[model samples]
Target: MPLVHIDLIEGRSEEQLRQMVRDVTDAIVKNTGAPAEHVHVVLNEMKKNHYSVGGVLKSDEK
Candidate 1:
């Protein structure tokens, strides 16, 4: 089985997130020849305030 992990900031619509996972799964399946049922996807969503860049929290960005 192949595992794919993904992370993104919170707030995307369910459909959008679903599409993203599907795309990742498709890519992995095509490249690795893994069966779709055997591929595992993990989606990690964090709050904007929990992530930072340049010492500024993502929630604080303009």
Candidate 2:
């Protein structure tokens, strides 16, 4: 089984997230020769305040 985890900031449309999962899963299946049913993808949405870069929170940057 292959497990992929993706983390991103919130606010993406449902379709975008769905497409992302599909594309990522497809890529993993193609690259790793994994079965579609055995490939698992998990998406984690983080609050702006929970992420930071360059000493600034994402919420503050925006």
Candidate 3:
């Protein structure tokens, strides 16, 4: 089994997330020859305030 973990700042629509997982699964299957059913995708969505870059929180970005 192949496991993929994706983390993103929370803002994307459900359809976008779904499409991303599908595309990722396809890529994994094509590259590793793993069955689609055996590919696992885990998505972690963090609140903007919970994410930071260069000491600035995403929610505080101007």
Candidate 4:
């Protein structure tokens, strides 16, 4: 089994997230030779305020 963790700023639609999971899982299965059913993808969405770049919070920048 393969476990994939993806983190990004929250904003994607349900469909987008679903597609993302599917694509990532497919890639993992292809690269690791794992079965599709055994591939797991976990998405973690973070608030803009929780992410910082160059010492500046995303929420505070714009």
What is the alpha-carbon lDDT for the whole of candidate 4?
0.92
Best by lDDT: 3
What is the total number of backbone clashes in candidate 3?
0
Higher-ranked by lDDT: 3 or 4: 3
Q: How much is 49 displaced in model 2, in angstroms? A: 0.9
Please provide TM-scores, in order, for all candidate models, with all chains considered together: 0.95, 0.93, 0.98, 0.92
Q: Write the per-residue lDDT of candidate 3 for residues 1-62, one digit (tens) a residue.
A: 99999999999999999999999999999999999999999999999999999999999999
Question: lDDT per prediction?
Answer: 0.94, 0.94, 0.99, 0.92
**Candidate 4 lDDT score at position 33:** 95
Model 2 per-residue lDDT tens digits across residues 1-62: 99999999999999999999999999999999998899999999999999999989999984
Best candidate according to TM-score: 3
TM-score of 1: 0.95
Candidate 3 TM-score to native: 0.98
Alpha-carbon RMSD, each predicted model: 0.6, 0.8, 0.3, 0.9
Please provide, for model 1 over 1-62, each residue's C-alpha lDDT reduced to its tens digit, 9 standing for 90 to 100: 99888888999999999899899989999999999999999999999999999999999999
Q: Candidate 3, overall lDDT?
A: 0.99
Comparing 2 with 4 on lDDT, the higher-scoring candidate is 2
